[model samples]
Target: MKTDELDYTLPDELIAQEPTPKRSESRLLVLDRDAGTLTEDVFSGVGKYFESGDCLALNDTRVIRARLKAEKLTGGKLEIFLLRELGLGEWEALVRPSSRTKPGSKVVIGESVNATILEPTQAGRRRVVFEDGDVLSILQSNGEIPLPPYIQRKAKESIDTGRYQTVYARAYGAVAAPTAGLHFTKGLLAELKEKGLSTTTLTLHVGYGTFKPIQVDKIDAHVVDPEDFVFTKESASALNEVRKNGNRVISVGTTSTRVLETQYIDGEYRTGAGLTQCYIYPPYSFHGVDTLITNFHLPKSSLLALVYAFGGTELVREAYAYAVENKFRFYSYGDAMLIL
Candidate 1:
């Protein structure tokens, strides 16, 4: 498929700048693939579409305060966005003003953390080594939440610290949130459980690559960056049991879906932990997920391609067009879609 096939025109105003007042209050667009229909409802009422014994698989990866402000020795201000930890005090980071911060450059982060730029890496990133202290602790005091570039705000408000993350986020490693899970609240999860739905969590540390655009004209030429994921024995057993009983496995987001699909082998879920670059696009056969609950994704993105693969090309195209015409919000802090 051509990457241009996924393109859609979205008004700038419809890109969500802020979250809903309440998490569960966001609108839900239900796409019933079998029926070839689309319906709109409140996210809190999403449980009504599920049958008893259905499994809800969610990503529990927590977003880290990866965006840090720093100043070079020459007094040039720069932003260092932490991508992944390379261990031994070194990290792979995207340093803004990369032209200014060369391999030997030194920058000060707050009062306590000083870092030396080590080397340049692919895609305009830098290798940074921090001077003697816990980097995570330093981030807690001086770092800011790495909001997506589409959210044009001069400064992050207090609400962003909490609202940008899911209620169930636990394992802390992700630079970005598994956004599809953001609409869920504790009350909604409990309500689903009371309806005889079982929920399990796997961790996929969402990387900045999730927002990477498909630069290639042909979709098959695009490659996804590897992201680490953890699917435990307990979670595997729980989801496998759901399939054994003939229940649906509803993936909460693309991140969780990737982990499940990566670990599924020989017609069953397997327990494991590793990095996965499992890119999903149109014409791909899904082996793990029966239903998908996801947020509206950017046009010409790999994320949108995955949704097209799951929901069928023409149906998703119509659904996106309907969403735009109805003035539904878009992107991370936006409304959701349940593809059944």
Candidate 2:
């Protein structure tokens, strides 16, 4: 498949700059994969389509304040976007004005947070070690939420801290949120529980690379960045039991879908922690997920490619067209789509 096949025209106004006031109030677009049908509904109605025994897999990774602004000893302004943690005080991050921040250069954030750039890595990433302290606490005081570039507004630190994250976010490592899970609220989860539907969680620390566009014309030639994920023994057993009991396994987002597909080996899910670079596109055979709940994706992105792979290309294109025509919001903080 050609990468161009995934491209679509989206009006600038359609990109959502902020989340809906209430999590469950966002619109839901339901796509019937087998029937090639599309329906519009509210996100709160998500439980209505699932059976009693279905299992919904959700990513519980938390978004950290990865975007930090600092100043060089020489007084040049610098930006550091943390991508992955390497150790207690070390991380791999993207540094702005990379040419100026060389190995051994020091950048200071506020009065106490200081870092030394160690070396350059692939994808313009820099290895940096910070002065030891409670890193999360330091970030809370000195960093800002790394909103997507297309949002087109300055971060409102007080508000985005809560809005950009999901209600169930537990593990703290993700630079980006598993956006599809954003529409779920505590009330909705309890409602699904009452309906006899259960949920299992896995963690995939969403990296900024999730937004990386497919550079190759041939879809097969595109490469994805490896992201950290963990599938515990408990989650593995729950998912396997869902399959054993003949229940559907619905994945909450592409992040969860990637982890599920990556861990599936031979005939079952493998439990443990590992790095995955699995890329899903058209003509791909899905081994774990029966249904997918995801947000609309950017054009020519690997995310859109995976959506086209799960739901047929034409169907997804039509659904996107419908979203545009009806003025449904797009991207992170956008409305959701359920592929069933």
Candidate 3:
């Protein structure tokens, strides 16, 4: 498919800059694929559409404080965005104003935290080695929340530290949040459980590549960066049981959907952990996900392509038009869509 097929017009104001006051208060857009209908509701009432025996698979990857301020030895300021850990003190990172930050360049982060740039990696990323203390501990004390570029803020606010993350985020490695899971509150999840809906979790550390644009004209030419994921035996057993009992396996986000589809083989869920480069797009058949709950994605993005693949192309186009007409928020901190 041409990349243009996924393009849509969205007003600049509709891009959500901040999260809703309450997590469950965000608007929900329900797309009944079978009925070809679009219905709106509050996210807290999402359980009304689910059957008692249905399974909800959630991504439990936690967003880290990856954005850090650094000062070059020449007194130049730079932003080092940590992507992933490579070794005990080494990491894969993106350094802004990299034009002059060649190999062997050194920068100081905090009073005691310093780093040396090693070499350039794929897609202009750098290999950085820290010199002072534990990398994770240094990030905890000095790094800032890595908000998407669309969210404009003069300074980092305290609210973002919590609101940018999901209520159930546990494993810590992701640079970005599995946004669909952000709408769920602990109270709302408990309510769903009481209603007989079973929930399970897997970890897929959302990568910066999630925001990578589709530069190719043809959608098939584009490649997604591999992200680390883990599907444990317990989660696989629960989902398989749901399928055995003829219950729906509803994926909470595109991240979880990728892991489920990747681990699904021979008509059964398998336990595994590794980097997944699953690039789901239109004209593809789904083997694991019966339903998908996701947030509004950016125009001409791989994420939008996956959504279009799950929901029919024309149906998703109409739904997006409706969302724009009704002024539904867009992007990571935006409202949600449940496609069934």
Candidate 4:
């Protein structure tokens, strides 16, 4: 199908610029897959859907401070946004001052660190190879938090660095937060456990792929950038137990869903840790992830396409229509939808 066909209009005012004071206080729009119905509630009410014995899968990929500012020897300023780690001192990145940075130009980030712009990579991204003895050390000492462009605030603010992350972030690799996980709170998890709802965690280092625009006319031509992910045998075993018990295996975000599905090889789930470039769109079958909890996504993006796949295309279209008309929030810090 044409990518444009999936696009919809979202008012600029509806994009949430800052996170709410309390993560669990955001609005929740409940959408039933079977009945094709919509309901409104608070995010804290989400725990009510899963009774005792149900399992919720969460992504624990920690967001790294990936934004960096460097100066060229020519006295030109360059903004470097690290997209993902490609190993061997190489990284996929988006370079500002692209015009000034030629293939051979060296951008010095600090006294002991620099980057050389290599050949251009796919999707207008550049291959920037780092020249640091310790890449992670250099980034930790100089890099800034990589906030999404939609938020019209300074990423240097204390709240930006703190509030942009989830309480459960553990594996430090993601450039962006799996925002759907942002709505969860420590108290909520404690309550879920106290009520006997099982929980499991995996890691999917979110890359720019989650936000990459649909450039192709036909959605079929679009591909994704590989992101680092990990699914251990313990989590897989817990999920299999849930499946055997006939309880719901609810995914908290697309990151968790992708990792779970990536670990699914034949007809069963396995344990593995590596990179996955799984591109999910509508009219596709989902082997894992029975239900989903996600935030409102941008029009025509692959994320929205996944939502369309889980909740039928017509259901997603109708729900998005209602959300727009009803002035619901959209994007990173926006409202959420629970598909059951």
Candidate 5:
């Protein structure tokens, strides 16, 4: 498949700059893949479409405050975006002005927190170690939320610290939030539970690579960076039971979908932790996740390609056109779509 096949026209204004006043207030676009149908409704009412004997799998990976500002030893300003933990006190990061901060360069963040660039790694990333108090605590005091670059706005007040995270977020590792899950509120989740809809949680630490645009002309040529996914034996057993009972496995976000599709084995969901670079594009046969709930992805992204694979290319394109026509929000702080 060609990368341009996933392209769609979206007005600059439709790219949401801020989240909705309420989490569940965002719009939901429902797309019937087989029927080629589209419907618009409030996200809080998503449970209306799913009945009993269905499972909603959610990504519970927590987003850390990963963006750090500091000064280089020579007094140059530096910005480091933490990607993932390499070990205790060590992390993989992307540094701005990478040319200046070569291996062995030192940077000081805040009053006492200092970091040393160990070496350059794959994809222009740097391995850095912090010599300070607990890295997590230091980040809480000095680091800022690593919002997607497309947002182009800073998190306002202190509430953003909480707003940027999903209500069900628990495991800590992700650099980015699973935006589709952002539409869910505790009340809405409880309501679904009351409807006899079972739910399970998995963890995929979304990396900064999620924001990287596809550079290859051919979609198949694009290689994804590996991200860690945690699928416990309990969660797998629950999902397998859902299948055994003749129910649908509804993935809450693309991250969860990737974990499901990648970890799914011979008629059973696999258990334990693993890394996935599973690239789902058009003409791909899905083994798991009968339904998907996802946000409006950016054009020419691997995410959009995955959507094109799940929902037909033309169908997704038409739905996106309708979204643009109806003024549905776009991107991370945007509205959602349910592909069934």
Candidate 6:
């Protein structure tokens, strides 16, 4: 299918610059896949759709302060966005001015931290290793919460540093938050627990690839970069048990759904750690996920296409149109939708 088929025009004002004062206060657009209908509702009404004994899975990967600003010894400023850690403190990252600095170039941030470029990734990304020390601490002090380029906000104010993360975030590794999960609050989680809803975690350190726009005219021609994911034995065991008992597997975000679906096939669970480049489009058969809780996605995006695949294509299109007309927030740090 033509990538242009996925395009939709969004007004500039509709994009949320900041989060609502309360996480659960955001709007919820419930899309009933079975009924092929959409309804506007409050986010707190999320639990109304589910009864007791259902499993809701969340992506627990935490977002790091991954955007770093550094300069070459020649004092030229450069921006580095951490993508994926290769191992031994080496990471694949997006580099500005990558054209100027080739292999063996040195970069220093502020006065204390620095790194060396080992090489470049296939997509012109850099393979960089920080000067020996704790990379996380260095970023914590120097970097800011890396918002997507489309977001108009410039400075990472003290407020965003906290709001960008979900209350359930743990296992720190992500460059971006599992945005759909962002709408969930600690109070809401406690309520779900009390209501007899169980939750499992599958970590996918959300890399830039998940958000990078698909450029191919034919969606099938596009290639999605592999992102790291870990599904532990405990989580997998619990998920299989849920399926066996005919319970719902409610995926909290596209990240969890993509990785979980890849590992779950033929009614059996494969507990493992690996990278997945699974791209879901129309006609894709979902094996594990029963319901998906996700945020409104951007047009011409693979994420949106995946949703159309899960809930029929026409159903997603109508849901998105309804969301736009009803003033529901959009994108990362935006409102959410529960598809059942």
| Alpha-carbon RMSD of each model | 1.1, 1.0, 1.1, 1.8, 1.2, 1.3
Q: Model 1: which residue pairs collide? A: none
Clashes of each: 0, 0, 0, 0, 0, 0
lDDT (Cα, tens digit) per residue for candidate 1, span 148-267: 989998436579989989999999889988999999999999999999999999999999998999999999999999998999999999999999999999999988989999999999
Encode model 5's per-residue lDDT on 183-226: one tens digit a residue. Answer: 99999999999999999999999999999889989999999889
Q: What C-alpha lDDT, on a 0 to 100 scale, does residue 40 get in candidate 1?
A: 99
TM-score, model 5 to reference: 0.97
- Model 5: ten consecutive residues of lowest lDDT: 155-164
lDDT (tens digit, per residue) of candidate 6 on 42-72: 8887988886779888999998888998888
Against the true structure, what is each candidate's TM-score? 0.98, 0.98, 0.98, 0.94, 0.97, 0.97
If both were scored by TM-score, which would come out higher, candidate 3 or candidate 6? 3
Misplaced by over 4 Å in model 6 are: none
Give per-residue CA lDDT, model 4, range 102-197, as digits (tens): 887788896768788887787667888887646677788888988887777777565767777888998878888999989989998898888889
Root-mean-square deviation of candidate 5: 1.2
Q: Which stretches of candidate 3 lie over 4 Å from their true place?
A: none
Clashing pairs in 4: none
Which pairs of residues collide in model 5? none
The whole-model lDDT of each prediction reads: 0.93, 0.93, 0.93, 0.86, 0.91, 0.85
For candidate 1, the per-residue lDDT at 117 reads: 84
TM-score, candidate 6, is 0.97
